[model samples]
Target: MKGVSTIQSFRVYKHGLKRLIQALGTEYVNLQNVYERLLVGIAPSHRIEAMIDDPFGELWREAQLLGRLRLRLWRSFKNFEDTVHDMREAVQEMMEKLGIGPDGEVEWIEHTSIRRQYKRVSFILQRSNYHDLLTRIREGVSSLQNMAIMNVNMESDRILRSQVRLNQLVNVTSNNIYHALRSTMTCRCQRLHEVGLRLTPPSRTIVPQDSDDDVIKELQFRLIISHMGPLATPSVRQWSEVLLQSARSQVREEPTTPLATKSSSSKKSVKFSVRSSVSSTNEFMQASAIIQPATATFSLGSAAMPVDSGMPQQIRDLCETMQTTEKRRSGDNCGHIQDHMSAKPSEYGVYFMDCLGDCENYVLVPLKDVLRDQSNGTLPPMLYSDKLRLAWVIACSVLQMQETPWIPSCPTHDDFYVVQKGGVPQYQNGFVLKHLPDRGGPGSTSTSTTSSARPTLLSLGIILIELILGQPLESLQPQDTPASQLSPSYEAANKFLGRVNMLGDLGISAPCNVVSVRYLKARTRRVS
Candidate 1:
C-alpha cells in the first residue's frame, strides 16, 4: 500500500508539471496573436482566409510559441540555477520516485499521450479573453482600409503606363493615315474623275455630258468616300517603324515633359494628365499624308461598346450604388465564414493559395464563357490553345466593353465575387481592388463587378504570343522555362496560322524579336 501511494503521488506531480508547460505555451501563442494584430491591424475577411491557409502563418505562430516556451523555460533555469549543482541528483530522484530504477537506461516514453490532456485546458485559458480580442480586431479594421488606399497609390504608375501605351498606339494608327491622305486627296480624286470620263461611251460628249446638279453630286460623293476611305483601308507597314522608334524614345527618357493637370474630377477623385513629348519624326507623320501608312481601323460607335449607354441614368446610378454595398456585405460574410474554421498557423498558407486560386479561376472561367458566347461562330478558323493569352484577351474585352474611363483594367475578381454575391456591386465599379491580408483577418473585396476600360495594345501583342504558344502565365516563371526555349507548339501552329495570320489580317506586323525564328526556336525549347 505504501509503494502504491508513492507511485500515485509521483504521477500527480508529473501531471501538474505538464499542465504548467502547456499553459505557458498557449499563453505565448495568444500573446503573439495580440502583438501581430496590434502591429498590422485586421485584414479583410477574404485576405484573412488566404493568410490562414498559408504555411507562413502556421510556421510563424509555432516558432513564436516554441520561442516563448524556450524563453520561459530559461527563466525557470534562473530560479533553479542554484539547484543545477545537484541537477543529476534531482533528475535521478524524480525518476526513482516515478518507479523507474536508475539503471541510466534510456527508453521510449509516450510523452505525446501525456501532453494531450493539458492541451484542452490550455486552449480554454488561451481563449478566455475572446471578447477583448474581438473588440480590438474591430478597432483594427481601419488599418486594412488604409492599406487599400496605399495599394491604389502604388499601382498608379503601372496604370498610367498602360494608359500611355494605349494612347500611343491609337495616336500612331490615327495619324498614319490622317496625314498620308491629306495631300493625295486632290490628285487621287481628279485621277478618279478622269478615269470615269474615259470609261464613258464614245457617242457622248468628250468631257462626258452631265447636268450641274449631277456634277456637284458626283464631287460630293467622291469627297465623302475619300474622307471615310482611310477608315476602311489597311494600315501601311511603314507605320510600324514610326511606332518602334517612338517606343524606343519613350524607353530612353524618364518623362517627356511634365504638364499641369486637374485633380479630383469625381467622387473617387481619379486624375488624368499628359506629361510626355512627341518626337520630330512623329511631327512629320502628322504633317504629311502619303508618308503615313493606313492600318486596320475599328469603329468607336455604340455597336463596339460592351455596355448599353441607353439605360436610365437613375437606374445606372442605383446599380453602381448597389455594387459598392454588396462588396462590403460579402466581405463581412467571408469574415463570418472563416471565423468558424480552424485558425491554426500551420493551415494558413495552404488555405490562402487554394482559396485565392479558386476565386481567380471562378471569375476568369465565367469571363471566358461570356467571350466564347459573344464571338458566336466568328472564332478563328485555327484557334490557338493558350490559356494565358486567352485570359488577357478576356480581361481586355471586358475592359473595352465598359462605358467609363475609371474601370480598372485587371481588377481582382475575388473582390467582384464577394461584392456581387452581397448584391451591392452597383457603385464604385471602376476602382481596382487589391487585398493585403493581415496576420489573421478578413481581406478586402471589390465594390464593383464592372470595369469600363480596356488593356493597352502591348498587352494584346503578348496575348498573341501566348495563343500561339499554348501555355499558361505560370510558365513564364523565371526558373521554370529558360528564355532560350519557351514554346514548340507555336512552330506547328505558325505554319497553319501563317496562311491567315491574325497580325497580318489586322494589318500590323510584330517586331522581329517577337516574330523571329530564333526567338520561336528558343520558345519551342522552353516549352519542351
Candidate 2:
C-alpha cells in the first residue's frame, strides 16, 4: 500500500518496541519476585523490612502502569506511523520513571527501590558487590534493542541467582536461640486474656486447642515467672499445692529437670551463666522448645554465682525465691497465669527515660562553659569520692531488683546548663531545663524485675565515663587513621591507666608513690 522505504521503517520501529517491552517485562517480573520474597520471609521487627517498604511499593505502581502501556501499544497499529511514535513516547516515559539524569546516572537520594534494595542486600550479605549487580541490570535494559535472546536469558538467570543467595544470607544471619531469647528476655510477657483483655472476641470454649498462639504465650509467661518470682496473690496456701503438683509434672516431662524434693539434686543441675550455651543449631528456636526452667538466669552478673554472693537484695531474693518456686512448677497451663500485674511501662509500670529523645531539640555546648565560675582557679578536679558515688549509684540501679534508694542522676558540665539556687543545683534557682525527656517511674510488669534498670545502667555508665575523662568517648576517632582497626571508642582510659601503672607493667608516672588513683580505677573497672 505504501513505498518500500516507508514499509521497512515501520517494521524496524515495531520490532524495536517489541524488544523494549520484553526487556522491561523481564526486569519487572524479577523485581516483583525479589520484593515478595522479602515481604513475607523476614521477621516484622527487622529494620531492613521497614526501609524497603516504600520503594518496593512505588516500583509496584510503576510496573503496573508499564504493563498497561504495553497493552495499549497494539491498538495504535491502526495509524501505522502513529503507532511507532506512541511506542517511542511510552519508552521515553518509562525511562524517565527510572529517574535517569541527563548524564544517565541515578541519584542516591532519590530513594529508588532498585538502589535501596541493592543497599539492603549489601548490608545483610555483608558484601558490597551490589553495585556491579545493579550496573549489569542497567546494561541489560540499555542493550534491549541489540541484545540476543540468549544474552537476556543469561542476565535474568544471574540476577535470580543473586536474589536466592541474598535470601540464603538472610537465613544464615538470624540470631541463635540463646542470643534471640536473651534479646527479648525483658520484652512484655502477657497472657492470652491479659494483652487483649478478651476471651469472647477470639472466642474460646472451655477447651482451647493444644496448638495455638495462646500456648506460646503460656510458655512465655511460665518462662518469665521462672526467673522473676511470683507476685503477691490471695490464697497463698492454696496456690502452694497447685505449684507443687505443677513441679512434679515438669520433672516427669523433662527428665533433666531435677526433683527439688531431693537434697542431693544441687550438683545435678546445669549451672547458669550470663552467656548460656545455645541448645542447638536450629534456624528458629521456640521458647517452649529450648527454654529450661532451672537454667533461667538474669543478666548483669556472672553465671554460677552462689546465693550468698551479696548480689542486690531484690535480685538475690528473686533468684532464690524463683529457684524454689519454679522447681515445683507445672506444664503449659499451670501456676500464676493471671493478669494480677501489667508490664506496660506507660500504662502501669514506669516508662524509663530515653537518652537521645527528640535529638533535634538538643543543643551541644562545650564542657568548660558551665563550670567557668564553680571554682576559684582553673576548675578544681572533681572529687574521687564524687566519681565513686555516681558510679555506685548506676551499678546498684542496674544490678539490683528494685532501686534500694533513688539515685540522683547528675548533669555533667558540657552536657547541660547549670542554675544555682542558694547553693543548690536545679531549675528552681532559674536554670532553664530544655529538651529533657520524661523518665517516667517504672510501674509493674508480669515480672517486676530490674530489667528496666539494665538499659539505664548501660547508658549512665557511658555518661559517667565521659564525665570522669573530661572527653567524649568518640573523640579519639581522628587519631585512629586505620579506623576499623580500633573500636568506636578507643580505650582512652587505658592510656591514663598505663601511665599510672594500673595494668601492671609500669611505664610512666610521677613515681610519687603518694596520690591514690587505685580507688578510682577499682570503681571504674567494677562499673565497666
| TM-score (C-alpha) between model 1 and the true structure | 0.17
lDDT of each: 0.26, 0.27
Task: For residues 337-408, write the lDDT of model 2, one tens digit per residue.
Answer: 111112311001001111211112322223334234233344454444543443343332222211211122
Q: RMSDs, each prediction?
A: 33.4, 28.0
Worst 10 residues of 2 by lDDT: 192-201
TM-score of each: 0.17, 0.18
Largest TM-score belongs to which candidate? 2
Query: Can you give the lDDT of residue 292 in candidate 1?
Result: 12
* Candidate 1 lDDT over residue span 1-528, tens digit each: 855655565455445434433433343334334324422323344444343323123322332332222222222312222222232233233333322232322122234443443333233324332334333332333333343344344444544444444433333322222222221222322112100000010111101122322221111000001011122331210000000011111112222111112212321110111112123223322221110111111111110101112221211121112222212321121100001121221000000000111121212122222223323433332233223333433344333322221123333222121111121221111112211111222221122342322123223333343333322222433465665554323343344344335445332223212444544565568799
Q: Number of clashing residue pairs in every model?
A: 51, 10
